[model samples]
Target: MRNGKATIHDIAEKLKVTASTVSRALNDNPRISDATKKRVLKAAKDLNYQPNNIAAALRSGRSKLIGVVVPTANRNFFSSVIRGIEEFANSLNYKVVISQSYDDFEKEKQTIEALLNVQVDGIIASLGKTTKNVDHFKKIISKGIPLVLFDRVTNDLDVSQVVIDDYYGAFQATEHLITEGCRRILHFTSAQNINIYKDRKRGYEDALLKHGIGVDPELILFSDMQLEDGRRIMQETLDRKIEFDAVFSSSDYSVMGAMQVLKENGLNIPQDVKLVGFGNEPFTSFTEPTLTTVDQKSIPMGQITAETFFEILNQKDQGSIIPKKTILKPELIIRNSSINKEN
Candidate 1:
């Protein structure tokens, strides 16, 4: 019986009981006697029976599954977000289905389709760098599925969104440098598809303008959010013989790149060129002079995102509630890198 396919009827036949009784025992119905349940279990064990997940999902009204799509799960920023999502989702008795798009728009679309095919109850996502099409997301909305966008969100989509105040954070970082007496500040940034980079750029530029400093286009370097991009941009700065007093980078990794070169050239931080980086990553503190960066309250952002998604799930009058764009203020962490010590 274990070698061949085993069925409820097979167990019933062996036990001289009706199929209904066998089913009840297997289901552990309260009405079934303990002795009968034990017998049915033993029989099932002997037959090596297994329940089908697909069949079970079909029987239940909900798949009890939530899909999570991120640009890359490997990134420290996104991994923290995923941790927050998983923690909240688990407490609500829902399972998570995760997929990575590697910042590819087409791959993101394909992953969403697959999630839909599996009938996920909801979706929580951070848009990829290359994701320009909002139609895929719109379709999810049209299907009446709840979607919570965290971190990277599209402006076109009218949905629940959780984000940090990038502009303010950027403003604060740049302002700190200006107050420290660093003029001719340089700004390093990446693509403007996402609001974070754009806001930081704005903050940096605005701070300079407010301080009566003329904005220099040559000082603004566009770079990819990669270690090599940082190294390459620093090299370009050297090749151009661009004299600058300070540097503000939108990414911590890029700041690290700039610092490596600056240190090699024996230019002291803060004394020669004040430095500030966004995204207060872990390595920021351990660096030689430590790093002055912006802390976006990443953990809280994740928790709020999870809470928002759950609220949408439980609210009976979800349509009546205004679509929310929750923005949290960013905190500027001033460290040794950006502050000068008078001898």
Candidate 2:
């Protein structure tokens, strides 16, 4: 009846019942008799009746939908987090709408606006690299919508966040390299505009200071942490004759690039130059020499993010929910890449 779709009125007409009775029966109202409810359900099935969720949402003032924004869905870390979010949200009978920012600030703002237009109940997001100004996110708070940040978050926002201890993760990785006798360790990292990368850089520096190794400014190279950037940086380091015994990259892709350059120059891994990477990407384990890296507990982070949103929803006043910061500990995964041959 509504745009050629079967409606409660159609079911009522087929069953020779009033539309109100059919509606109550379809909703399983206790006032409806069991026989009548069964009959209405059967008629609905026969007519293929479908309830309009948008209409129901308008009536109830709740969409039962959650929006998730990530930098990229292609990366294993984000994908795994999404899977965990889906798992928990589905269990609670909630649906999730996902949007990818692609690390672009404009795209991120557009996606958030689109999600808001659809009247989602809540949003969970990781800030994009280019998202320096967070006024757009503040707008979500202004609209009384619950927002939770994960992974790459900003301290300027007073919202719930789920993240790993990136500082400790980097510290452990750097200290591991030092223990393996890597004196002149070159750090391949990304821009410090993002909080996660900044924490990693600080951790790397602190680890060196703790182990009596002075931080070398020339050895700390900043890049986009892409494969090509890694390759280019490594080649330039070689061209400049920079002395380094180990390479600690903030990204697995960057490590792969460095590995390629090292291999081409006939440098043996763990013998000539030890290596370590972050993210614990799948490829790290299967490489010629498995990469030592840090596991960010991405799935757990996702689950916690969803759980926190649910808690926010339960509160009578959204603003009353205290700003929560949940930091999960990072685990160091040791492998062949950074282990000294003598050890």
Candidate 3:
């Protein structure tokens, strides 16, 4: 064994065959005989042979490795997306290198640069909250490397991407509350710069206007949509006496915080204030009155994102990527939180 790891040459020596023969046998090349291939395989197992992917990648210029970047892996949505990416990638004999940006633009830039340094065949990413300038992504395009975005994407970069219909999901949630007789519906959202948050806001506004309930600026609240942000915004609404009958949040985490505040204030869910949250987190089902939420289809999102990346990669040698946008439909799960019978 060389360097405590069995190399192809080590297997060749074990079986008393040429290094080329061992290589061909290991690759299952048609030129090699079945008996010799069987001998090479057994020798490989006995020696615990491992292929040097880096050397192979250098020779072929195809890394068979993909770099995946997300805001954070802590969220169930992002974690599930990673799983989906891995499932699809692994089927094609590819490996994934995951990196987190933690919502920092600088970190995202550095992460992408590091991925480039590793000579990854492609990169699949979701834009971080603070990533307004997309020059880093543009640089990737300029280098003729495949870059596909999913979920949190920007329109500035002409890249292939996939995302759930945030507008439709938000519209459905808002309309559901309206049907529940909620006129003064409160809204929790993030910054308008991000496409998902903006689409959701538009949906909420259109739903209210469609139902003859004008959008009240006072009822609209903006924040990072973190747990603390939800609690702070909700408390601010009550302190200012915004007068809201229902709450619709763009994030399940934030709405959970709002629920805690409501319970503390002695407000009965679905009785006094109907609530609906986006992102069908697992905890939503276990809540006191089970929070109504939207399913972003994380599994499908990840699968499609992987497919989109490969599509771009397969077409790279042909020319630049012809940017494609795939929008998936989201599902709204109705639960005890949004069904107010007495309202």
> lDDT of all predictions, in order shown?
0.86, 0.91, 0.91
What would the per-residue lDDT of candidate 1 be over residues 1-343, giving only the tens digit for each residue? Answer: 4557788888899899998899889878999999999999999899877754455567764777889999888767778888888888899888889899888889999999999888888899998877777799998988888898988887889899999999999999999998898888889997788777888899999999999998999999998766677778887897788999988999998988999888877888868878898888889999989999999787788789989998898777657656799999989999999898962
Q: Please report the TM-score between candidate 3 and the true structure.
A: 0.91
Per-model TM-score on C-alpha atoms = 0.87, 0.92, 0.91
TM-score of 1: 0.87
Quality of model 1 by C-alpha lDDT: 0.86
In TM-score terms, which candidate is top? 2
In TM-score terms, candidate 2 sits at: 0.92
Of candidate 3, the 10-residue stretch with the lowest lDDT total is 313-322
Query: In candidate 2, how many Å is residue 3 off?
Result: 4.1
Give the per-residue lDDT of model 3 (tens digit) for 1-343.
Answer: 6579999888887877899999899889999999999999998888878888778778889889999999999999999999999999999999999999999999999999999888899899999988899999988888888888999999899888899999999999999999888999999998788899999999999999999988888888999999999899998888787788999999999999999999889999989999999999999999989999999999999999998888777774637447899999999999999996654
